[model samples]
Target: MPKSKNKFGKYLLIFWGLFITPFLLLIIIMFMASKGWIGEQLPSFEELENPKSNLASEVISSDQNVLGKYYVENRTNIHYYDLSQNVVNALKATEDIRFEDHSGIDPKGLLRAVFRAGKAGGGSTITQQLAKNLFHEKPDTKTERVIQKLQEWIIAIQLERRYTKEEIIAMYLNTVEFSSNAYGIKSASRTYFNQTPDSLSVQEAAVLIGMLQAPTRFNPARNPDRALARRNIVLSQMNKYDFISDEHIDSIIALPIELNFQVEDHNFGLATYFRESLRNDLLKWCKEHINNATGKPYNLYTDGLKIYTTIDSRMQRYAEEAMREHMTEIQKKFTEHWKNKEPWEDHREILEEGKKRSDRYIRMKAAGASTKQIDSAFAAKTKMQLFSWKGDIDTIISPMDSIKYFKKMLQLGFMSMEPQSGYIRAWVGGNDYRYFQYDHVKEGKRQVGSTFKPFLYTLAMQEGYSPCYKIPNIRVTFDLPTGDQWSPVNADGKYGGMLTLKEGLAESVNAISAYLMKQFGPQAMIEIARKMGITSPIDPVPAICLGTPDVSVFEMVGAYSTFANKGVWTQPIYLTRIEDKNGNILQEFVPRKVEAISEETAYLMLSLMQGVVQFGTGGRLRGQYKLGMPIAGKTGTTQNQSDGWFMGITPELVSGCWVGCEDRLVHFRTLELGQGARTAMPIWALYMQKLYADKSLNLYKGDFEAPKDPLNVILDCDKYVQPGDNKTSFDRDF
Candidate 1:
C-alpha cells in the first residue's frame, strides 16, 4: 500500500508540473511584453504620456494679424454654437454617465466587457477613448490594440491631470469623428441637420449622439430607419438614466426628424474650386516657409492649422443657386421639346437612351465607320438602325431622339478689395469645385477679349489722345510675324466710316481701336497694360486693340477696381490676421496701395465703359436690370466664340465673369449666341441684382475733361513732327 501511494504521488506531481509549466511561461512572456522587453521594444508609459513631444506646433493667428484673408464662418447664412448642454447630456446618457467620475478605464464595465469578450475585451473610459482618438497611433491587430489601449490609459491619466472635466468634454466633442468626413460635433450638426449645436432639438441631438456608436450604420442622411431606431435606444437610455424626464423622452420620440438639404458653410458652387486653389497656395506658402527653415514637408490638413479664407459665404451660395437654376432651366427647355414630341413616360430613361445612341455614334466614328461601304439595300437598313425608322418606309426615322443636353459649364470669379485697405472682400474661383479646381479669377490665363480695350483707351487718353479725337474707322489689315494676314472686324462685320474716340469706344469699333493702336504705337499699349496690373503676356500687335492679351479675371477685376477707387490700384488680400493656437500673433497682412492711373484718366475710362454698357453690346443688361447706381463694364468675345468675358464694377464692388468650354471649342451655334453680352453678362447682372437689391449706392455723374490735342502729352514723339521749324510745328499742332 505504501509503495502504491508513493507511485501515485509521483504520477500526480508529474501531471501537475506538465499543466502549470506552460501557464507560468505564458505569464512571464506577458510580463515581458508589457514591459517592452520582448522582441521589438514597445513604447513605454513615459513616451505615451508626453503628447506634446509628438504633437506638431499648430500656427494660429489673431483676427487682426491675418492678411489678404477674411474670417468667414463656415456658413454665413446660419449661426454656429459650441456643443450644447442638451447634446452633452444626451451623449452622457447614451455613452458614459460616469465619464467624469471614472479613471482611464471603467471597472464594472470592464468586468462585463471581459465576460462578454472572453479574450478580446476593451475597457476604455470616455477619457481613454478621447485620448485614443486624439493621440494614439492607429492599430490593426488584437495585440496592437492592447498596446494602444495601454498607451491610451497612460495618455488619459495625463489628460485628466492637465485638463478639467468640461474642457475634456469640449475637446472630445471637437476632436471625435461622428461621420466619415465629419471630424467633430460642429461639422456633424451642420452637415446632417444643417443646424447649430445649440439650436439642435432633443431628438436631433440624440440622433447625432447615437451616430457616435456606429456612424455608417446609423447615418441619418443614408439610413433614416436605422438612425431612428438608434436614436430611440439613446432616448430610452437617457430616460432610464434620469438625464431627461419621461415626458421629455416621450415628446422627443414623437417629434419627427427634419433634415435641411442646404448645408451651412458648405461652400457650394465655385467656392470649392476657390477653396482648393487657396489651399494649394497656402500649402505652397507653408512648404516654402518650412523648406527655408527645416527642409521638411508641412501638411496643412493634419497640422490643425486654422485657415481663414476670403470666400463670401453669401455670394458663394447665390452663385451656386444661380448656376443650378440656369442649368435646370436649360434642362427643362430640352425636356419640353422631347415631351412635346412624345408624351412623358420617363424622361430620364429617354435621356439615357439618347445618350446611348450618341455614345454609339461616337464609338462607330472612332472605329473608322466612315471607311465602311454598304449596298443600297443594306444602307437603307443601316440607316434605319442608325436613325430611328417610322412604320412607313418612305419616312426615314432617327434611331436616337434628341434629348436636351446642357453641359455643366460655369466659370465665374470675383476679387473685391477695399480701395484704401486692400483687404479682399470676397472671391469665388468657379461654379463647381468638384469639376474644375483652377481659380479662373486668379489663374485662368485666357484672352482678355475686349476687356483690355479700356487700358489701351486709358493709355491713349494719358498719351494725348482726347476722347473726342477723330479716328478713321476704315478697313485695315496687318501682317503677322508668321507671314499671316490678320484683319480685325466688328461684331456685325461692318466698318463705320468715321468715328470720334468716344464713339469708337462706345460702339466697340475694332477698326477705330486698331487705328488708335497704330497712332499710339504697340509699346505704349503694352506699357499701359503693365501699369494697370496685367501680369500676363501682352502681344504688342494690332489685335491688342481688341483685347487679345492673355490675362485672368482676378487681374481684370483689380484693374477695373483702379477705376472704382479713383485711380489707386490695391492688391487684393483676403486674410487680415493669423495667430497661434496659444493666441500668439503669427502674421498680419497690411494693405498696400499703388497709383496706376490718374483720377482724370480713370474717370474718362469709366465714362467710356459706362457708355458701352448703355448703348453697345451690353445694352441688354441695362434694359433688363435697371441698376440704380452708375456702373461701368466691358463685354468681350473671342474668335469662333471660344471664350466670353465680362468685367463690371461699382464703387463698392468689382466682379468678373467668363463662360466657355474648358477645351476652348466654339460654344454657341450662332452669332446671336456668341457674344459676352449674351453668355456672361446675364450671370454678372444676376449677381449684381442680388448684391445691390437693398443697398443704396451713390452715383457719379461727373463728366471727364478731355485734353486739347494729341501732341501735348506725346512722349518724345519728335519723329511724328511735320518738317518745319520747332516753334512753327508746336504752334501748328496747337
Candidate 2:
C-alpha cells in the first residue's frame, strides 16, 4: 500500500511539471525580450525620451480664432491641466477603474479577468493601452499579435518608470484617434463640439471617451444612436465607480447628445479657396526658410507652423453668407430661365473636360488601365454625392452628367482688400469650392468688361483728361492701327450728342471709350494698366478700351485698390506672419508698395466712378439698397452677357466681384438681366451692408479724400452746366 502511494504521488508531480513548464518558459522568454536578452530589441532610450508623432499646423485668423489646420495626423497636444476633470474622470471610469492604484499593471484585476473570462472588462491599465497605442504595430496573424502583446507589456513598464500618472493620462489622450480626422482630445473636442477640451461638459466628455473603443462604430455625427448608447454606458460606469453621483448620472443620461459637427476636411471651411491658393506660397516659403532645429525644410504638413493670415474671421463669415444668400436666389432664377432649354451648348466637350479631371481616370491610368476601360467607367452611372448650396446630396449620376450639371450652375468669385495696407480682408473664390475649384480671383481670367474702363479712365486722367472733359458720344469709326475699321455702339444704342467724361463713363458708352482709346493710344493705356498692378497680359489694341482684355478679379481688385489709396499701389498680402510651434517668429510679411499714379489723377478717376454709382448704371446702390455713403464704383457687362463684374471702392476698402457661367456660351441673352449692376453689384451692396451692420468691424464711413493739393481736374458736373437743362453739346448736368 505504501509503495503504491509513493508511485501515485510521483506521477502527480510529473503531470503538474508538464502542465506548468510551457507557461514558465513563456514568462522567461518575455522577460528576456523586455531586457534585450532575447532576439527582439526593446524600445531604446532615445525613443523613450522623444516619441515620434505627427503634429498639425494651424491657420489662425487675424481675430485670433483657429480657422483650420494643415496636418498629417490632425493631432494637437494639450497638457493635463487643459483637460477638464470631467473628461479625466470619465476616461478613468470607462477605461481603467483601478488607474489610480495601479503602477503600470493591476495584478488583482488580471486575476479577476482571468477568472471571469474577461466578461467584466480588460485588465490592461491605461499605461498598457497607451503602450499598445504608441509603440505596438498592428499584427497580421495570431502569433504576431501575441508577440505584439508581449512588447506592449514591456513598454508599459517602461512608460510607468518614465512618466508620472498625470503625464500618462495626457499622453494617452493625445495619442488616441477620435472620429472625423480628430486625433487627440483637443482636436476631438473641437471637431465634435466646436469647443475646446477645457470647456467639455460631463456629457460631452463621456461622448468623446466612449469613442475610444471603436471610433467609426460610435461616431457622434455618423452613428448618433450608437454613440448615445455608448455615452450612457460611460455615464453609468461613472456612477458605478462613484466618479459622479446617481443624480448627476441620471440627469446626464436623460440629456441628449448635442453635437456641432464641423468636418475637418480641406474643402469644408470659410477660406477653402484662399487656403488652396496660399498652399503654393507656403511650400515655397518652407523651402526657402529651412527649420533651424530640424536642419531640414519646414513641412507645412507636420511642422506645426502657425500661419497668421490677413483674413478677418468675422468678415470672412459674412462674405461667405452673403455669397450663399445671393447665389441661392440667383440660382433659382437661372433654373427658371433654363427650364425649357438645355443648360450646356456642347455636352460632349464638357464630358471630355470632366474625364480629364476625374480621380478615377487618373488612378486607372496610373495603373495601366486601357482607354476603353476608362471610358466605360466614366459612362457608367454610379453613386455620387453632389455638392449643393443647401448641403451635399447623394444621388446616382454618371460622371459625364455631373459635369454638365456643374456647367449649368453659375459661379461667382469675390475679393475685398484694404487699399492702404493691401491686406486681403475677404476672399471667396467660388460659390462652392467643392464643386468648382477654378479661382476667378487669381487663376482664372475673363474679359474685364466695363471693369477695364476704370484702368483706361485712370490713364486718361493721368494724361490730363478731367472728369468734365467733353467727348462726342455719337458713333465714331476708328481706322484701326491693325488696319481694321471698328465701330462700337452703346448698349442702349442711343447717342448723347456730347457728354462729359464722367457721364460717358457712367453710361458705359462704347463709342466714347473707343474714341478715348484712339486718342490715348492702346499702348499708353496698357502701360498705365501695368503701373496700376494689372499683371494679366493686355493686347495693345483699340478694342481694349471696351474691356476686351481678359483679367482676373485679383488683378482688378488690386488695381482698384490703387485708386482708393490715392494711387499708392500696394501689392495684396495674404500672410501677415508665421510662427513655429513654440510661438517663435519664423517670418513676417509686409505689403509691397509702389506709386501707381499721382494722387491727383487717382482722385479724379475716383470722382468719375462715383458719378456712375450716384446717377447712372449703379444707381441702384441708393434707389434699391439705400446705401447713401460716398461710394465710387463701376459696373461691367461682357459681350453677349457672358460675364458680370462690379468694382466698388471706398476710402478704406476696394472690392471686386465676378459672376458668370463656366462656359461663355452659357449666359443670359439680354443685358437687363445679365448686366453687372443687376448680376454682381447687388452682391457687393449686400456684403457691404453686412459689414456696416457689424459695429465691431468699424469700416470707415464718409467720403474719399479730394486731392490734397489744388486739383487740376474738374470733378463736380454742376460747375459746367445748370440743373434741369438738356442741350446737345451744351455740357448740361441733368
Candidate 3:
C-alpha cells in the first residue's frame, strides 16, 4: 500500500510540472516585457503613471465661455466627476460587463477569446484598451503582435494597481478618439451636442459610447443611420446588464440620434479671425517663453493652455449680427447704384491687377503656365461655394467671375474696446473668415479717410485751439515743393461760410480741414498721431490730413481710445492671463499706458466730436437709432467713396467700423450711399443699440466727463472765447 501511494504522488508531481512550469515561464516572460526586458518596448513606470495626450489649447472669453481651440487634436480632459453616471454605466455595460469585478483582466472572457479565436469577443477590458492607446505602436510580425498583446495585459495590470477603477475609466474616455477632430469625451460632447459631459442625456451618452467601437463608421454627424443602430445596440446591452430597464431601453433605442453637430474648426465659430490672430501671437509668445518642466518652448497647439481673453461672448455675437445686418443692406444698395455699369469697367487695368493677385493665377504661374493658360484657368467654370449675405451659394462659376463677385462684395472690420482698461470686448475682422482670410482689424492697412482728422484735431487742442475756433470754408491752397499749388475739393464744392472748428469737423469740411492742416503741417500731425498710438507709417504730405495714408482698424481704435480714457493711451489688449493644463497661472498681461494728451485737451476734443453726432454727418446716431447716450464720433469717406469709417466714443466704450470693397477701385458713385455716416455709422449705431438694450453690460449712458481741474481752455464760443465769442459762448451755451 505504501508503494502504491508513492507511485500516485510521483504521477501528481509529474502532472504539476507538465502544466505549471510553462504557465510560470509565460508569467515570467510577460513580467520581463513589462519591465522593457523583452521582445517589444513598453512604457516605463513613470510613463505609465502619466500617459501622453495631444490636448488642444483653449481660448476662453471673459464670461468664461470657450470661444474656440487651437489644436492638432481637439481634446480637453475632465475628471471622473465631470462625467455623468449615464456615460459611466453605458461604458461598463457595452465595453466591459464585469468592469468592477475584474482586476485588469477577466478570466472567463479571456478564455472565451482564446478558445473561440476572438469570434466571441477580443476580451480587451477597458484598462487594457486604455493601455493600448496610451502606448500605441504597430507590430510588424505575428510574433511581435503576440508579444505586444502580452505587454498590454501586463501594462493593464499595472494601471489597475496604480489607479482606481474610476480613474482608469476617466483616462480611457479622456484619451479616446471620437472622430471630427474631437478626441476625449469633453470635446466630443461639445462638438456633437453642444453640451458639457456632465449634462449629456442617457441617449447621448449611449451614442458617444457606441462611437468608440469604430469612430468613423458610427459618427453621428456623418453616418447617422449606422450611429443610430450602434446606439441601439449599446442601449440593448445596457438593458441586458440591468443598467437601464427593458422599458427604458425600448424608448431609448426608438429615439434617434439627434445631434446638434458643429465641427471643431478654427475657420468656424464665434471668433475665427480673433482666434487666428491670437494663434499668430501665441506662436511668437511660445517661442519667447519656455516651459519650466520640459525645458523646451511651449507648444500652442499641443500644450493644453488656457488663454483667458477679454472678449465678451455676448458682445461678439452682437457685433457679428450688426455686421451681417448692415452689410447686407449696403451691398444691395451698392449693386443697384452701379446696376448696368461696373465700377471697374473704365479701369480694367485694376481688374487685371486684381486678377494677377488671385490664388489661381499664382498657382498657374508657379506651375509654369503661360499667361494664356492662366487666363484659361480663371475663365474655366467649376463647382464652387461663393460667400453671400444670405448664406454660402453653391454654383458653377468661373474663377475669374468668382474673383469679380468677391471684389464687388463688401468687406468690413468692427471692434469695440473698454477705453479705461483697453480690453477688447468684440472684434469682427471680416464678412466671412473662411472665404476672406484677411483680418481687417489687425492685418489690413487701408485709408482711414476722415478718421485721421482726430489726430490733427488733437494737436489743435494741444496748441490751445478751442472747439469754437472758427475758419472760413474757402479753398485753402498749399504751395507744393514741386512748384505747383495743392487744394482740397469739398464734396458739395460750396465754400463761403465762416464755420466754427467744431462745426467744420462735424460737417467734415475738406477746406477747413486743409486750412488746419496748413497751420499745423503734416510733421506735427504725424507727431501727435504717433503719440496717440498710430503705429503705421505716416507720410508728411499735406494730403495726409485728407486721409491718404493707409492704417489698420486696430491702430485707429487704439488711437481713438485715448480720448475716452481721459488722455491716457491704453494699448488695446486681448489676453488677460494664460494658464497651464493644470490651471497654474503662467503669465498675466496688463495694458500699456502712456500719457498721449492732457485731460483737458481730451475733454475739449470730446466736446467738438459730440457736435458730429448731435448735428453733423453722424447725426443719424441721434435721429435714426435714437441712442440716448452722449456720444462723440467722426465720419470718414475716402476718395471715390471707396472706404467708409466711423469712429465713435462713449464714456465706457470706444468702437470703430470700416466698410469697403476688396479693391479700392470698386466703390459707390454717389457719396449718399457710400459715405461713412451712411455706411459705417449705421453698423456702429446698430451695435450700440443692441449693447444698450442688454442692460447686463451696463454700458455708460451718461455724458462725457469734464476735466477734473478748472478748464484753462474755452469750449464756449459765445463767451469771450478768442476763436468765436459769437461775440456770446457757444461751448457753454450748448
- lDDT: which is higher, 1 or 2? 2
Q: Output the lDDT of residue 580, model 2.
A: 88
Model 3 steric clash pairs? 716-731, 717-730, 717-731, 718-728, 718-729, 718-730, 719-728, 719-729
lDDT of 3 at 156: 88
Question: How many clashes in each candidate?
Answer: 31, 0, 8
Query: lDDT tens digits, residues 323-367, model 1?
Result: 445434433433443444433243345444444445555576566
Stretches > 4 Å off in candidate 1: 1-81, 103-123, 135-154, 260-270, 291-297, 323-431, 436-439, 476-487, 493-498, 575-585, 590-592, 663-665, 694-734
Ranking by lDDT: 3, 2, 1
Indicate the residue-level lDDT of 249 in model 2.
Answer: 72
User: Residue 101 in candidate 3 has what lDDT?
Assistant: 92
lDDT (Cα, tens digit) per residue for candidate 2, span 1-734: 99999999999986676566447756876676767653354577767766656789888889998777889999887789999999999999998888888778776666565556668676788998988878767789997776676666678878888998899999999999997989999999988999899999999999999999999999989999999999999999999999889767787799999999886888887888898888878889999988876789999988889999999999899888888888888877777777878745555676576677778878999999998988887789999988776888899998877777777788988999999999998999997777778787888899989889887888777776668877877887878756889888889989867888889889888888888887788888899899888888887778898899989999899999988898899999889999987789998999889998999888888888999987789999988898877899999999989999999998888999999998888888778888988888888999988999899998778788877688754466566543334734333222
Stretches of candidate 2 above 4 Å error?
A: 1-46, 97-121, 139-165, 221-226, 292-294, 343-401, 720-734
Highest TM-score model number: 3
TM-score of every model versus the real structure: 0.72, 0.86, 0.94
For every candidate, C-alpha RMSD to the true structure in Å: 10.5, 5.4, 3.9
